[model samples]
Target: MEHPAALAGPPIGWRDLDRVLVVRPDNLGDVLMAGPALRALRHAAPGARLDLLAAPAGAAAALLLPEIDAVLTCSVSWQEAGSRDVPVAADLDLVDRIGHGGYQAVVILTSFSQSPWPAGYLCRLAGVPVRVGMSKEFGGAGLTHWVPSPPDELHQVDRSLHLLERVAVPPFGGRLHARVPPGAVRAARVLLGDRGPYALILPGASCPARRYPAGRFARVAGRLASSGLRVVVAGTAKEAPVVAEAAGDVPGAVILAGELDVPALAATVAGARVVVCNNSGGAHLAAALGTPVVVLFAGTEQVGQYLPRFVPASVLTVPTGCAPCRQFTCPYALECLDLPPERVAAEAVRLAARGPVRTSAWSSVREPG
Candidate 1:
């Protein structure tokens, strides 16, 4: 499947890239962090038809970006193992589809730890002329341009942007962006009901290792309510029990679990004075909407690398000997995740001082019926 590069000149040039496919099959937060890089790619080649390949969850946020002309979805085995158990036929079909896309180049965006060579191999299999990725260990046969991943730990946004920089994409303001659906504003307004200085409490994370205790979240919500700020606990429908536990009978506290779609949730975050949550997608969404945040830095990952950098945020984490383990299952029963609710509450109050900044630039594409 290796199509030898024509001997006319260099391997590839940015100006010659007309249609491109950028692969980032991860999660919501990961996709949002890559927002600036995506915009840079589009800006560098304004005429190119830029497409994004994201996971199902990531696809929702990806579509919100105006830079992406189209979006394709796939849950990579490395990222989401056992999520899709399709046979080899399905994978081959995708390769064939990508080959037919008529893309002149393909770029695979991955985290510093994750290897993009496998994804690059897919692009090669699909007959993409130029394949680009970051791989320090192994990538000779996988990619045409084997750029070295940054050695130092950087913010996820910076990491993605760095990859684009190595590939010749010019820099832009490091701002995260996501579009709010047309109906989101009205829906959010209806739920909030003329509330001032409301605080959003995200009580769940994609993994248990990243989630704070429900009781702690409840205490934080109560504290916020006591401070005269309306508290709204939000998460997916599956997180209803956690959200309910956190909002339990708190005065002026609303339970909005499973109530809003991605755009609606973004709208709600945009309206909130501050969002208090574990290291999760909600934190990233708030960053994109320019809202302040109080991020509970669970010991599952490095705080410096994953914490939102595009917005004002106060990150809280208990110092632990084995912290930043990046393990999904904590052998020590998550001793590092226990932080005083009062500390989180204080940070939320300080951040909410900015007051409710309600205006937004998110224009929805269509209204839900």
Candidate 2:
């Protein structure tokens, strides 16, 4: 692969690059929402080896994206000051690893609420030539392509795509994606074995601020079971208690919390007739797999920015005056998510009746707030 000019231009199109590292060091939902932007990067730099630098929370989603050629993960302790814990050896090691990767360009994707300079500083330390990011904060010499921070109204997908325009990667607004590995496919097949046509209920709490009552989730599961669809509940090992509560006493309901890895979970979601989840990662995964989704949305975050994308989706949310408060702790006890089980179940059943859409292609679906 040819090396980039030592002092390259800011618009040194990703297509001309030999290697590029895309950075999204955040949650699963964040990475999943960045799918369209990653797809844009792949198109812009078809010949360039597109690698990813992800946090432990996002690496699973990064690995599931077929656009990425490789993935590197690190749990950099992001401090309250919007910077990494530089004293940690793991962060330094990441800098060293990135330094050796020979990446000509590094495109950093951050949420509207995050600081990109922390990731940019690491790229700068690694001596990467063309660093790109969007930041409201001044990036100084750390970033070669500094996009002005986008409007908060932009969805996560659009925000990342907006940043990519700085480096000349376009063709925005596409569907979410997840590529299930053969191993994960096998694992999921074994786990679900012959459980025909199930409704997947992911009752795990991705964020305390956005969680729906587990009891209501169990009711939704029971509702689906009554409609002749078997139920499968998924959650992380850490979410076992929540999963157990949501799977409680439901006839033929399968508890899969802690039993499947991210990719296997993706596979399971891919096979589901429909998915019932909170405003969380599973909803994004379902969006990626083109599985219809029902989101028990809380108004803490902008519903437009984070709701499931592309596939058929039902957003069940109560109106709140303090909608999009952006607070992780609800002082009002999450009143925005005060949807009844029957209503949530009705929406889930409605989407389930439509069944899942099977396509890996990106989409141009859009919704107005």
Candidate 3:
């Protein structure tokens, strides 16, 4: 690899650079959305060793992506204030590890409003010559190539891939793909032995507004079971009680909570007839696996921005006057997800019958104020 000064002009056009590190220290859904950008970088520089730096929870998704040659867990704590708590010791250790790896370039992926300071500082501290990221703040001082942020309405995947235009062009509306390891598939089979096809319901989200009521999910599950569809409640340990309560007394309704990792979850979702979930990480994972997804959006987050990107998927939104507010908290109660269980069950039944749904008519109904 040539030194930064030895290269002509900027290192953006150089194809000979062999090692690159991509940093996306965000949540599971954001990390999954970064797959296309990673693939684009790998496609552009096939010989380049690709390393991913992400939060601990995002490590599983990063490990599953075939484009990444290595995965590094970041110790920085992220908060809704958009501030990063970079541990000094961990930062220094990561810097030393990256410095020793001899990376030629680094790409930092971030939203328009969030500062890429931590990533930029890390790249600089690690002595990586060519750093690429959007020029939102700091005036591109630390970046070798500063790409423009996409318009607000752009999908997260598109926004991430837009920065990669400096290296390569990706397909328009690129699909999100996650590989389910064979072991995970086997585990899913073992977990669901002789159960046959079942509908997986993920009723929890990190945000309160994004979560549909557990009682509503239970009602829907019971109705689905009565209609001859087996219901399986799936979620993390924090969501165990919620899923268990939702799956109550429905004879064949099983609660598979806290049993699988991301890849295993993907496999489990892949084997399912369909997935009904809140606007959460599991929804994105199910979409990536090409499984039919019924995502319930709370009208707080932008549906166009965070909704599942699968071909045949349904997005159920309330479309109230306060739709797309993207609020983390709701003061007057979350009416967005206050739909009747019968209606939700009907939609899920339709989805289960018709393979995968393309659009959502459920969003048309009005909710009482």
Q: Evaluated with TM-score, which candidate comes out highest?
A: 1
Q: Which ten residues in a row have the lowest lDDT in candidate 2?
A: 360-369
Better of 1 and 2 by TM-score: 1
Off by over 4 Å in 3: 1-14, 77-87, 138-140, 167-169, 321-326, 356-369
Clash statistics: count for each candidate: 0, 1, 1
Model 2 vs. true fold: TM: 0.89
lDDT per residue as tens, model 3, 62-96: 75688988888775543234465556687688789
Cα lDDT for residue 264, model 1?
78
| Residue lDDT tens for model 1, 1-369 | 222331222445776678999898888888888889888888888889999988888888865677888888876655655456667776787788789899988888888788887787778899998887776565556677766767547777888788777667877977888776667778877776764568899988877888889998989988898888889898899999999998878986888888887877888887788899989888998888778999998877778788777578998888788877877767876778788899899999989886544433222223445
- Better-scoring candidate (TM-score), 2 or 3: 2
CA lDDT of each candidate?
0.80, 0.81, 0.74
Ranking by lDDT: 2, 1, 3
- Order the candidate numbers by TM-score, best to worst: 1, 2, 3
Query: Please, what's the RMSD in Å of model 2?
Result: 6.2
At residue 149, give the lDDT of candidate 1: 68
